[model samples]
Target: MKRQLVLVALTICAVLPVAQAQKVGETVATPFQGFAHSAKGSQLRDQVNDLVALVRAKRLSDAERKAIELQEKFEASFDRKMRQYSFQSKEEYLEFKQSAPEQFEWIDWGYKETLQMKAFIAADKREFPTALSILATIEKIAPASAGTAAERGYILNQLGQPENALAAYKKALSLSTRYQSQRPFQAAALRGIGFALIELSKLDEAEAVFNDSLKIEPANKVALNELAYIRDLRAKR
Candidate 1:
């Protein structure tokens, strides 16, 4: 049973990066035609499009390499455009947020997506600390973001900090309830909480959490497999 649990951990560590990369592609690999049609921002749009293509092509290592360079470029360009707005005070920025929601969304989404790519790249490299740091920045930028908190839980779990991971997963669950758009994220967060409970040796609690996750996502393979493992553990006792 212990050996099987260890294998489950190893399998999760191996599969998660690929799954996350696919999610990143799905989230960001949309057509960029309307995003930045002007010549001034066309280069940035092209770069993003190319990166998305690379990810979709399964050239993730190459994509990760390109993403590092693109991160620097995007930050500089975004900063320049942000400077052009010249919000001199908090009130000015808040008013802009309210008055130009589309513009705010464009800038915010671009920056957050860029950071998310970097975070996934770092996670692929097994750089949990770096991934967590990037996610922390993302959380600050998008305070109510869903995946940011959940991904932090993933990194913390990879780093073998189950207690902290549990807290992060619960935070993700809490935030997810306030937003109904991403049911998969909420389900994933619940699975994360179950995994953390297992790590803490709270097998019974983990079983219940896994059942809860399965309730949300009946097709969640990870939760189903873990629940089976939990059952095996109990059957032996």
Candidate 2:
């Protein structure tokens, strides 16, 4: 009986790191609202949706190609718009952004969303290095994005770097607190922290964090499943 219990506990721990990996699809399916009002934006949105469909259909190679093409197309569109403004230099563009924040806001949001989709696709393919590189670009473009931090946490967790994942998840939670638009991701960040804690053999803390996640999103299947696993493990202990 003792040996059986130990084996069961070991199995649970072995599977803990991957509890959230399958949730990546739901993250990828999240729609971008930045470009919803314009015709070009609508086209870009459809392209992103197509990419998501490909990913969901398990066509990672197609998704990767589509992601690359979308990035190039978006860059071309951005450049065309910038040319219309006749900005002489990066400094001029920065000044214009500050002077006409409203005009620049949607563009910033669209660019960030496009980069985020690319990162999500890379992550879905289990291309951690590529995903991290794309996320770095997103960080440079939008440092305050809780979504980026949450993604970093998820990738780090998959890399078996629980300590780093914990920090990234914490940063995501902090950013979510400050950014109203990011609040929706708080439950996910909490769940990430819980998963990282589990990998670190901190089950008590992990249980608490998972509970917190459940409080935010009562229907979160990941959190519910993890909480059950924790209880089963503890009972065996």
Candidate 3:
């Protein structure tokens, strides 16, 4: 039960806007909103209904051009939203180059964390390759790319590819000695390895990895929750 709750928390924390439309709360103002939509908008509703059917079918027969076009639209939306944080955040980002030199070099402050959150959602949705692709782009730019590698491995484990996931986790571990000095991302890598081990069903190993992560980030809620769940599961067994 604890583990289930942990997963539920993770699901909520990791997931982005799973609902079809981007905006939520206040009002969509976009006519058709899920099942609550009006039957009067049948013409508009038909397209949504078709999308639902296609999603249920687990495949899209869209042509290559359409696929690319949709991907671009999604990417544009994601980028646009990433920059739409609080005014304070926008100001901080603008001043990133002048202040906080170490972190500023890393493609804006919250960029990596945002991508990590997005990847987590993708992993929960079983969109492994797409998640990896995002991580890969990050890897190409960040020197501390090993953390993303570990995350990718966890996603692989969730996809039932434990061997590959383990390999990726090991690669992340190997990065420890490679870094010239202690880096912030090392903590993230450790946490990722812990998550990968959990998904791989290596409980003992996962606990050790979580301990390592805690050594770096004692206040990490996800790691703390995960470790608690693992302890609960072990006690149950």
**Candidate of highest TM-score:** 1
Residue by residue across 1-237, what tens digits does model 3's lDDT show?
354212211222233221321232122223323322321222232333333343334343432233234334333434332222210122222343354434312232123334444455455466778878877765554334445666766666667776787787677666543442213345556666677677767889989987887887798787888888888788888
Q: Distance (Å) between predicted and true CA of 31, model 2?
A: 19
Model 1 Cα lDDT, one tens digit per residue, 44-136: 545655665565566778878877777677566554433323211233235456765355323324345556667766776788888888888
Superior by TM-score: candidate 1 or candidate 3:
1
Best of the two (2, 3) by TM-score: 2
For residue 121, give model 3's deviation from the true position in Å.
8.8
Question: How much lDDT does each candidate structure score?
Answer: 0.61, 0.62, 0.48
Stretches of candidate 1 off by over 4 Å are 1-49, 79-106
Cα-based lDDT at residue 136, candidate 1: 83
CA RMSD for every model?
7.2, 9.8, 12.7
Error of model 1, residue 53, in angstroms: 4.0
Predict model 1's lDDT versus the native.
Answer: 0.61
Deviating ranges (above 4 Å) for candidate 3: 2-126, 137-144, 180-182
lDDT of 2 by residue, 163-189 (tens): 998998899889767655556567878
Candidate 2 residue 55 Cα shift, in angstroms, is 3.3
Candidate 1 global Cα RMSD: 7.2
lDDT of 3 at 58: 39
Model 1 pairs whose backbones collide: none
